[model samples]
Target: MAQHDDDRRFSLRHLLGLVSRFARMAAFGALASVAHAQDAVSTPAGPSIALFYGANPPIDELARFDVVVVEPDARFDPRAHPKTHPAWFAYVSVGEVNPHRSYFSAMPRTWLPGVNEAWASHVVDQTAPEWPAFFVDKVIAPLWKKGYRGFFLDTLDSYQLIAKTDTARAAQEAGMIRVIRAIKSRYPKARLIFNRGFEILPQVHDLAYVVAFESLYRGWDASKQAYTEVPQADRDWLLGKAATIREQYRLPVLSIDYCDPADTACGPATAARIASDGIVPYVTDGDLATVGVGPAGQP
Candidate 1:
């Protein structure tokens, strides 16, 4: 009888232990679900207003938005600028040579194929392994020292404009991916934003915090010096692609449309359209010389 009683006791204790373990696991699962729900709820509904390629606004003005993208050499004191919840990012041209910079003179002229002279920026051979080191030393480090929080890497798709063949394009894309990965590894905490590099976004998406598309809905006609709406087909294609990135990668999409600031209606209309697609939008002039706060009381 005593033997049977001992067996019953052992069995009961084992059952109790199993029930306790399962209860603990269930509690943990519930807590994890709540945490994930909170994260989703906290995600920003829209991107904060941002400025790119312009003179720095006064400290008070700059504090109005959530981010500021500007040229690396732009004269501004980031440290002295009051924290307006804005994260300042310096611009770095990834695949183009700006003649205005003395550093371009040091780079071999051979690197530039001179295919597109529209922007007065020469497209460089991204496949060249030496470019990454130069960019880190001259661009990334300097911006970091200036107290900038991150980088706005541009011209990533310039190679596609100049590439003559599929093989050449693939090589250029691979090179860009390598350089972006290197930069991410070097500065893990820095926020990196790529401009209109949708072709290579899949490969480097993990390394980037945001992707910006310039001239999305509207583009500037350099010859006419007027704003023109993009074709419906192009708009549809871009919106579809942006949706995929946002859904699959969970990265915020930022849209920049060029328009005449004097046309008051353009800014609000563009912002509403972009926000409807769940993307952040900024309407600015072609040169990006002036700042547009977007309709009054809107950020």
Candidate 2:
């Protein structure tokens, strides 16, 4: 009887030990899984390859990109819900008025004295008191409500067109600074990207998240319908300026080089040259209907 009782007690002890060991292993495994999940969430993804100035692609196709720039009234096929999607910015231009619109009905007394023949767009007088308010109310507010996370703020360089004298140029730049500051104040969390606003970059660098240069390496030849390399001197000057903005302001530089879609070499070469300067490159058609990849397979 004594022996049987001792045997029973030993078996009970062994079962308890097995249960404790299994519980500890399960707990450790769960903790390791949680740690791995957190690490995956924290790791930053690669820089986004983006498209601009075109109708929105299919939602699944659009999801593949990291950023997109579209007109205020541009339509989306499936209706992009960017707020719930992976991090991306939808940008709208702020400084130039689209020439396609009826100017008189859109805004009274806002257009600058001349039309930009090259783009068929009217430059806005940034100094006009009502200009910023009109933009915020009519453009920025509507887009923000539609779930856009950024502003492209094109035509910051348009000030260069009207500023014939040093004093006039300085005033134009100051006006740009004021408008940018106002946008920043209103939408503190929104991403602000200035397009080729090199002269005004130093003044508004703190307020901007990115600076983009269009046609840095290649541009469309309307006569030949082909891509042409920019002059070496021009390329050197722009690259130098881009480097300064990147290093000094700690801002990322984005380069948009337009190329003839049929020229396979142009896309890869331009993207490589732009990337060599430590700028994110996007090679697209003049109308930006398609996205091109770099030689290194970067988007």
Candidate 3:
């Protein structure tokens, strides 16, 4: 009788211990639920951008929107101005380097495929393993520390030429992914915006939050004049790229194109096509800064 009583007591104690362990796990799962609830990005108003130091739109005007894209070298002091603007994306060209940029010195001759005389953006050698890190460390970190929200990766189309349609494409893409992931690891809150670079959509389409489609109708000439053409084939090609991003990534796109600034546009069909595409069209001379904001900075 004594032995049976002892066994019964032991069994009861073991059952209680199991119950305690189960309760602890349930509490832990509840806490994890709370942590996961906090991870979503805050929804804000529409996106806006300024060129040449936000001169086209006063900082105040630019601030009216949720996100503002700016030049990499543009002067900005987030603490100095209003605090509430949700996101500010700084522009950086990863595929190429402008000769005037500080990093141009680190560029090697081996990296230079050639130059686009029209845009004047130097084609850098993305084949270099260290090039992407240099951009993230030098350009991206500084902007994020300065309170810029994310990055506007511009002139990425230049990558198509820098890398031959062989091993270079994959290599260039891997390098860019490394660069973007590095930025996100440090500032996980910052959004990644890719401009052009449509060829690599399969790789980076899902990586970016917003994308800007370029060279729709009026591409700029060396003289900065609006060289206009419908080029239905080109328009269709770009739309196809947009379709890929939307289908693959489900990210919002901000399509940008050049048109005549004055009241006269080269063709009415051009204006209609831009509107139909459901992208933000900036109908101006190639220069975005001039017509966007007046001297007083009224929109």
The most accurate candidate by TM-score is 1
> Highest lDDT: which candidate?
1
TM-score of 1: 0.80
What overall lDDT, based on C-alpha atoms, would model 1 receive against the true structure? 0.77
Rank candidates by TM-score, best first: 1, 2, 3
lDDT of 1 by residue, 1-299 (tens): 99999999999999999999999999999999988776554333545757657666654655567777776666876777644667878888888978887588878777787655677789988888787777777667777888987888888889977788999999999888878877877788988888888889878888888888876688888867889999989888888878888889888888788878889778777766666666777778887777764423544
Worst 10 residues of 1 by lDDT: 38-47
Cα RMSDs, all models: 9.4, 11.7, 14.2
- When 1 and 2 are scored with TM-score, the better candidate is 1
Each prediction's TM-score versus the true structure: 0.80, 0.76, 0.70
lDDT of each: 0.77, 0.70, 0.63
Q: Which of candidates 1 and 3 is the stronger one according to TM-score?
A: 1
